[model samples]
Target: MTTHPLLQALLPLVDDLSRELAEDERYRRLLGTLRALIPCDATALLRLDGEQLIPLAVDGLSPDTLGRRFAIAEHPRFAALLAQRTPTRFAADSELPDPYDGLVEEHVGHLEVHDCLGCPLFIDDRPWGLLTLDSLVPGSFAQNDLDNLEAFARLAAAAVKANQRLLGLARQAEAEQQLAARFREVAGQAGRAELIGQSAAHKRLLAEIDTVAGSDLTVLIEGETGVGKELVAQAIHARSPRARKLLVSINCAALPDQLVESELFGHVRGAFTGASGERSGKFELADGGTLLLDEVGELPLAVQAKLLRVLQSGQLQRLGSDREHRVDVRILAATNRDLAEEVRAGRFRADLYHRLSVYPLVVPPLRERGRDVLLLAGHFLEQSRARLHLRGLRLGGEAQAALLAHDWPGNVRELEHLLGRAALKALARQAERPRILSLEACDLDLAGTAAAAASSVVVAAEPPSAPLNGDLRQALDAYQRQLIQAALTRNADNWAATARELGVDRANLHRLAVRLGLK
Candidate 1:
């Protein structure tokens, strides 16, 4: 005894409900099986995203149809199909404009659909999306075909349900990992990055991170210098399903123009003068994980194009090699520069900028975090105390007041260094280490150090008196040189220390120094 043909066509979909599959693959298989059973010129599976219907898979239609979005209000045919739960077949002379007009493959010059059959898929008794089949021949779908489609629609809904359940399980696992990591951090594990704030701005940033971490969308983190943009990236990676994999970072601004491409996409042996051995770049190293492109705005135009290619195609080639290597990498880019302004100025690629900023996140500056400064200060103080091997370390009354009053131009990094310095100064004033060392306002020296550091101009340009002397660009360069020179002197010519003092990434500082001829 043989089972029915329709049941045979649907058996694979039932088998799929027990197995894991990519969402697109599942949808594609569903459409393929449906077309095999019911002949049609075109078919598509669309998922409802708000008021828009996004095509997840399409068959016998123009390839571009997968990219086209149909609004429910704009397409009356789609609206009619979604109005009911069961199958609906439109008449040959239906007055409504078909969304697929001029979209059927190989059919030239505005081919109008004559027959259209669609079933609104329901999950938990609510409208989820629609499955549609189109034919150029009129009266192509009969009552039996409609019944067959209605039966298939139930299996389609089950496939969607299974996909959703699998996704939920993955997210649940990632969430569990995030919670465990947080618990470990609170239990005094070292080297773990923490957000460390309770202010509204900080809370909002955390919420945004939580919302975007489950998916593989590229996130562009934008903020001022030392605003903990990298910390935000870490939080995102830690909460994602890729948390178990490595989280690699490359400072784009640190490398020279010639080396940036090699550092990102890698090179084969003897690819260049210095290429002695085959080396995998950050993209390859970060396979099945995350890559944080620090100072991504500083990437050169040529490198930007290649990077965009990798992102768009998920395929890359090493330098001087014809072979393409496929990688699965989730990108998290952080930049202190205004990338949109850079794009307008022709300094950054607009296409790359748009791709990277699919989910833009802005980290709030420390000044906007209100009393979270004190909390962060306390966190740093404990770390300082641990390093100094002191019994206890706490801020004095005046120190707390001074911290609240002053504007933190350098952001969190500045506060951290200030606390460390203040702790040392307070310790030196005593003959022996006290049981609890309290840092006073005088120990901070906020006013004096900030003013002196702000006034450095060792290379001798036009003084502050001549504000508009020479070109505006030259004046800006002169000021930047002065600032870098001063910070270098204060940091004992340590580029890394100077970067922290100036609240910039060390690689970014190096790029600025080179551009300003101060390197």
Candidate 2:
């Protein structure tokens, strides 16, 4: 029991604890001490990506759950932990909601945890992950105990960093082996696009995209707007061998008419009136990276010619430069138009189309993705509900059927807009729940929707054009007046019924109607 040389040598080890807490070796040794200090049945370290929280390490958990996500929405305790990103302790039957209820029942039944202490992990003062401890006994922690646990979190954060720096040098060999092990463990877990669908069309599209993602080939993503073509392009770039490099985007539709050429290819001094200095173009800036030409259908003809030159020769000459320069840049172009038709019509270059289409991926519209639509809808609803601080919100059975029944013409974009609108209305308590929350929840103005419904042909209702000669406010008011009048007439001027149907408050609808002089 007397002090010994080992105990004398342990002072630095104690001093070194903070930065070493998360390192594997240190974590194991400190695990029993942490549990005694905090007194818990289970404790876990969670890693986060954006709002996602996945389990990383833990005690008292079975081997199967080392790497699974516990979504914040589904776990109430965890949700509050995320919102505060600070340490908290819970007692059995506490007033606060227990968010992790279902996960516990499903994952570890009968091993009931009645108390918890949670602390967020942060790096650079920005949140990085979470540290959590749970217990099965009620009233296990007093106020001072909770305070002490938070202190432990602070110390743990320090140890995590220190050990990470030290063991990082020694981890190279171990990391490689672990990585190889995980690659096999997660073989098929890399689900397609994180956007699920089993349809033959969807499968084929996935296969083609995967085949081209490993290559340096140019890719053209073709699809309707809202079909997530850009995300697919991102997937290709991210999964490609070029993932470590940059991925830049340019919306051809958004380019300035006078500056498109100089923007795509560099500009030399005095290239034009405003060209005051030499500059590198997008292609050069994207050297060793990927350039995404979004809305390629909108590119002007002159610009298209220059673009063709770059694709054909891998060379670009600045606007006023006599010499040409070359850079290594991969092109990923996306369009929602029928480029083959454009090529036949001479609007697009056939050879350019061929080059860009070496790997063509058509993202099927959401309506065609079968069960994926419902999954997406549920996901969107949860996100919208949380963002609006509305809870227990969901699509009623009728609403769900209507959403699935309709052919989402605007695709995912329309669905997101509809869900967002319904969540807003839910915040106001206007509708019981969103039934797609009522097609009225969407961009389907009563008149336009009815008109479209009546027609066997689906006509793209040109959004009311921007007025050339009036204030934008006036244009908006005019559009509102038109929509309100149509809704009133369609519903025979019953304010409550109209308001209910349109997902707006009766008073607000009346006010809008009066403002628009629809009386």
Candidate 3:
């Protein structure tokens, strides 16, 4: 007994339904099977997420397609497809514009009126998402094809459901759900502040965050500047038991040395020359909550002693007052500097470093996270689109290539700022507000930026000209100081870039800089 062609295609997915395949692998195999049966030029399975449709899997499309978020309101064709219950095939000459213009693989220019078919998937009798197929040839998908796609759509929904169940079985699912819900709430009210990535480095970071968030252990988040360490802290607090309580943060580097003690442990009237009245410090304000000591490496040795005492006893006195107040606060410290090296250099106290680094979390730099850069770029592009009130914004093929090729020294924050600037540049190039503005390589100018950065490194790497007049070690130290100082000036005091230019590890550079009094 021979089975139907659609049924043959779906049997493998049925097997996949019970297997322990990764979520991405399951979705990819589902799309692969759909393309094999349908013989379409492009196919995608997009999951409906509130007002937007996010691509879960794509076949015969650009890799960056998975990063894009298609808003139903912006794409009329998608809007119309979801409005119906059965599969939809647009007319060859349909006046509605296609959303996948210039997005079909190996096809240059915009996609014109052609064969477009979509089937809306439903789970538990509610709208879930859309299964779409596209081809350059008109009249390619006949009525029979639509019916076959409808069958495939049902199996696709099953695959999605299986993935959901697998996620639910995992112990981390509840925490992830809460995090997602909090993300949605905060995104609706203000700018979005959720981690967006699918790379292995990002997954490792997420696993670590999940592991440490459930406990009250002190966490030292160490990462380069602009790597979103504060976001990591927020994620920990959002997933922790003290989520409902306040998560206060103070920048140690922003305060004067004399005020550091008062800021963290509170101050009373007449404590200092500028002390006007009694005030609650960050620890008091964040009592029974979480407090983030940003730039913790910048704390003076004197203040570090007091902070260590408070961390040890949970008791602190207002400056110039003998009275003590007990509070329960969880400490989360962040720093771009290597505190261990600082301790070795006699700058940071070894005991205080030990107290703060109960569990250290290192955020991988942006250069190490591969395709995650595109996902993050998409996130930022969406934000720019909404802020600038543009109809739509997307990256051209060359622009994506540029982004992928560059080494992101500044990490996620750099990518966000770059996309924001590129969108505006692309918008200005258009004669009028385009329906879908595409950013080209020229708009990004990443190549030019890289060239400039390279030139600066060359200038900063030159050997010092001034002759030395002391012992061998003294001469070497003077030369090192000159090289580091020049690099720092050229790189605008970015220690990471300076380290890179000098061909030394960032931690080693910091230790050397401190020893030479160049910090």
Candidate 4:
């Protein structure tokens, strides 16, 4: 292993630092110190959520992945680690598929990192996450380096706990601020006309919302993530007579289980440790407006019952109050999951389901939303350029085509992030001339000839948004993954040879294969 000065200084501090990982305030500095010690170009902390590894803390990496997920089945190497439940090493010539291929070229541009070691952080024999280190050079780690890696990984386990708590607090603060800002934006605009969409489906959705928006009907807006369900709810509230009142929306899935109820219903003084004064529940604050319960499917069963009571009756009792408070709030619920299945599974109340779905409106995914992707992408690009002052920048025809071709599993949210990165790169390009956005700039590796071909041309005019047809996306992805895996298995996981024949990134091929469950 190549040893550096930073490691020499940090080696003595491992045990001490590992102990301090439990300290919340020192979390970042702890990760920062380890990042410096490893001298990696980028270091990331992944926390296990069910069977997925979610990137939580990142240093010297793209912020686009502050909360990105990598499913356990997505990568063979990662799967192998999970299966064996042990630390493993993978070099450029390892037997497993490389997980970082497409992601590296399109985002980090790190071509090196030949020697990689990963260790699972276990709390009570359950995997928490893995600590990853990447250097700018290949073949950098040796067997002797395993000790330090394990030490750091253990420390990362504790750091993950501290980090999650810190992040939870940070999220609460940010939610309050953003919610305040949003409420301010739409205040006193109730009973106003809604800016309904021109499309048939959208118009119908708006009509349904309008009928309920005025009646304090608990609405359920169902759709895939990033499909503008929140926007639909906002339109409902804005057009309703409740425009003069507060519209409170919160993502039920985003909040930790322990804090969901507390966050929704305000606490009384001395209710808990942090309750220094009385606070108001969202229902009370949105008394005359609407409370959008985003991702309502994710609500814990314990909390779901309470939410149901609030939806049924127009009254709610705060955390510490025995006195029931009546509120004139309208409820608008949204979810990306199949609540029908949830209801069947007894995870959600059937009564609540029936009540909220009184005005169920589904928003189409970007790929199925005919021309909306481009409209939204263009809108996002404009927003990016306007916010960043990125001048003389345009998406190339190839990039547009690639954007159109993408399944957009992340939906509109993903497009916004891609445009933001592309805009940043366009700024770098403006030193010479008008910067044309391409798949590369968008941070899409544009793997496969289809992707590259789609991205290479110049677009003459603005194109239609939401061009794709349907859920055949999952089928297509499955087919492609099947082909790639067949070839890799035939070649015994020889990615370089496979890439040579298929003519794509050996890395990306692996990553895609992993995503497809082919790996």
Give me candidate 2's TM-score against the actual structure.
Answer: 0.54
**Candidate 3 at residue 487, lDDT?**
81
lDDT of each: 0.80, 0.63, 0.82, 0.61
- Model 4 has an lDDT value of 0.61
- Write model 3 residue lDDT over 1-519, tens digit each, in one string: 999877887788788989999888988899888888888889989988667888878887766667777878877999999999899999778888777755676565654437899989998898888999998778888888988888888888888888888877334544555655664463342423467789999999999998999999999999988899999998898788876677788999899999888889899999989899999999998898799999999899999999999999999998989999999999999998889877876889999999999999999988889988888887677678768876556777888888887777667887888888888888887798887678899998775555443344334477768777886446656766777788888899988777777765476466557768986
Stretches of model 2 off by over 4 angstroms after superposition: 1-76, 79-201, 430-519
Q: Report clashes for each candidate as comma-separated counts.
A: 0, 12, 0, 13
Candidate 3 at residue 228, lDDT? 97
* Candidate 4 Cα outliers beyond 4 Å, as residue runs: 1-204, 210-214, 429-519
Global CA lDDT of candidate 2, please?
0.63
* Alpha carbon lDDT at 412, candidate 4: 71
| Number of the predicted model whose TM-score against the real structure is largest | 3
Candidate 1 lDDT tens digits, 269-326 = 9999989999999999899989999999889999999999999999999997899999
Candidate with the larger TM-score of 1 and 3: 3
Name the lDDT of candidate 3.
Answer: 0.82
TM-score, one value per model: 0.56, 0.54, 0.80, 0.49
Scored against the true structure, residue 329 in model 4 reaches a CA lDDT of 76
Give the alpha carbon lDDT tens digit for every residue of 1-519 in model 2. Answer: 676543343434466564434454576554555666656566777766434675545675432234244466555777777677567767787666542321231233343456777888775676667887776667776786667656666666666656656767335434433443343243322322344444566777778876898789998898876778877876676666665566677888787878888888879989999888999988988888789999887788777888888898889898999898997899999987778866876778887889888878778887777655655665565566455544234444445566667666567777777667666654555545432222223422323442442231112223444543465445555665555555566779765556566665343355456656876
Backbone clashes (count) for model 3:
0
The worst-scoring run of ten residues by lDDT in candidate 4 lies at 453-462
